[model samples]
Target: MGISTDSTPRYTYQLPVAAAPSEPPSAAEGAAASLQDALLVGNLLWFVRLRWVAISALTAFGAAGLLVRGAFPPLGLRPPTGWPFLIAALLLLANFGYLGHARWIVRNPQHRGAAWNLWVQIVADLLALTVVVYFLGSLETAAPFMYLAHVVLACIFFPRWQSFVVVVVASGLYAACVIVERLEIVHTPGIYLDPLLRQAMTGHSAFPWVTASSALGIFFVVWFLASHLSSLVRQQERELADANVRLTIAQRDKTRHMLRTTHELKAPFAAIAANAQLLLRGNCGVLPGEAAEVVRRIAARCRRLAIEIQEMLQLANLQSADEQPKPLRLDLAEMVHWAIARVGAAAQARRVTVDADLAPAHVVAVEDHIKMLLTNIIANAVAYSYEGGTVRVRCHVAASDGPVITIEDEGIGIPADKLPRIFDEYYRTEEAVRHNKDSTGLGLAIVRHVAASLEIRVQVESAPNCGTRFTLRFPRAG
Candidate 1:
């Protein structure tokens, strides 16, 4: 039996910052730990009463104790007059003591202790079995019970390989005991009961036949029980795994529903924002200076509101993507240039110096999805950056991966607490929401969803006042 010596280990989990990685324990280990704890709690009362060793130990000793007391001189029915029932009683008492020690070992689970206590119990059991076999005068009378206990111990405390080895050792002990008894090597008293061979049968020896039948029965019964227990454990493990899968599906469905609602709301608001911008640009004819400026501010706020709504919808769509990615070979360098060019006007308006370094390669990804991922990241960098600051967009080949893209901006960066959850839907940092009051906080969440579907990794590094860098690493084409 390999023992568990570590009380705890680090667990990994996925974080929300785009493709940030966090370590948490796998589902299987957690399920096993929960099952073990539940079983312990369910049997708490019984464990406390019997001191936590197997119930068989107590029952076996109790039965033998009753038999020993009943076969006393006062009963006046003892056929084996010279048999040492007292010795059998003493062996039963010793078993009780060993069980107490086993319980102690169970209660105190030492992560780095020797197996000294376990070895001691094994030796004590062996010695006790020897005494019983000698006192009973024959293997047919005493050795079967000892063999049964050995089998039980092996199943409870040992691995399959070790358990089988112990079973072989137990069978050998039985053979040795039987041989010694048959040869009359021991001179203790023996008990002989009548054998019902036929209708006219008289008293006949049945010890050999009975012992052989009992051993055969024990082998089959233990094997069946072990097989049944193993099946139960496997069935429960599968059920737990299925439940976790269902939970993930439900979470996605809820996120999708929210996104659809946001999209429905944004469609009308986008038209309203556009018309307002048109009027402010003199489409409705010229007006006084002060009135024109008021119209301009209203148009700007409406545009900001539209952007926030669009971001919310983006968050919902990112998490709700259920279909397989429609892959096609396309020039990724051109796509990057296209995205940067789309956002170029806005960056130039803010006096933000935008730079790009692109690599020539074909990438297989959905065109619209990649566009959204790139646009949001670049826009966020430009929006946060000060006038005349730099926003760098780089695309290159990674040594260990496929295409690697990074967008970095010189701007007031994210705080430590807010950085970890930057990709969560509707999650906005104080600084981000302050920069644009109507920020929808869905940009990074959409980025995560797209990367997850493509089996890509996204990472972010940022510190307050030190600017932020976002990295996207795509898997190579097959």
Candidate 2:
């Protein structure tokens, strides 16, 4: 006979009786590619956001001061008596406004539209800044210094082709300004070059060509230095990134090796202990009193050591496993049946009965990982159970949630204070320690790791002297 219900459940169990529904690549390259892309994108975003703010602010301040000065008085030449300075002022203001918007967007990257707008505004501002510099100073005058800002901006914000383009455009604009000023179309500063001895005695003039030539030369030098520096920085970033990846991999491998070694050592010990128990039980032949007692103690200690090794191995396995998961369709009903079948015999000895109500549903998960995860939870339910206790495993499926598997046991329940620490390695409740001293205190810890790897949300509910319940919910696949 099985537990009767209005609806037929997937799995049901009775003492010596059952009704059941049962069942049961490139990874490395993809992981590396994903890691590389994440780092590259992250770095690009940082540089763009930081440098854009700095350049835009300085450009706005300088343009505003120029506008204010030109509006008031003049230096030897007449004020730009037309739309030139006015247009420059407006462009500078717009650039400054957009820079402020960009800063806000940078801070809140979750707003995709704002971030996009910021990028567009930065590009427009760069263009506007280039034009303003041309009007303020031509190659023979202040144009050279203007290009210096563009060169620096290019080196920081834009990379190869774009940086080159900005420099060339600034230089070309400066040259054009020089020609117009010299023709008397625009008010251009005059140059008075001094001899080497004369220049040593007096400071350089405020002339166009002389100053433009010097400023333009400085622009080139700074541009070269910035380019060289950026290259070095990029190289160092890449090296550090590579080293970090190597270190992670080395750490994972080391953990895996240790776990595997622990498992290897544990297997032989388990076999020895099993044989010793059989001999002591007289499964082969009757043993003397002293020999039987000694065998029992040896077997018991071996069992304890085996559990410790198993726990260690589990930790090692989880630490070294792939970060990226391999997902596949999983049948919740079948997994419940399979898990019960695996741990059925162990529970029977303690007279613990399993009552599972799993529904027919599919979720995505790694097959072996899911099984190992369930085994730890179900086995624990059975192990902690008292004689003639019941372990109920229920699965619920909803339109929103694909499947929720809950394992609840009516046994020596955990205390409220100790529930939080139950998942920690080497931790056991006072009740558990008193009831069973052989526990290695790693079952729930392993369960936690497996749940995390599969992206499944797991939680527990317990009341002292009542029972414990562990629930695992799996997200639905699209």
What do the candidate models score in CA lDDT, each in turn? Answer: 0.62, 0.65
- Candidate 1 TM-score to native: 0.52
Candidate 1: minimum summed lDDT over ten consecutive residues — where? 194-203
Superposition TM-score, candidate 2 onto the true structure: 0.57
For every candidate in turn, the CA RMSD to the true structure comes to: 17.0, 11.8
Tens-digit lDDT string for candidate 1 (259-321): 777778777777777877777778888767998788778777777777777766665555553
User: Tens-digit lDDT track for model 2 on 1-478?
Assistant: 1122234222211111111111111334455555544443454455445555655555554555567655433333333333344554565566556556556645764443443443454455455554555444443234346446557756655455556666666656565655565565854332222234323422334555666566656766787888778777767866875665676667666776887689688869978998998898799999989988899899989978887887787676666644535778889789889999988998998899999887887878767667778888898888887888889999888767668898988777666666667777788888898887878888777776776666677777765556677877777864
**Model number with the top lDDT:** 2
Clashing pairs in 2: 137-143, 139-174, 140-208, 140-209
Model 2, which residues run further than 4 Å from truth?
1-128, 135-243, 281-285, 304-328, 349-351, 385-389, 411-431, 463-466
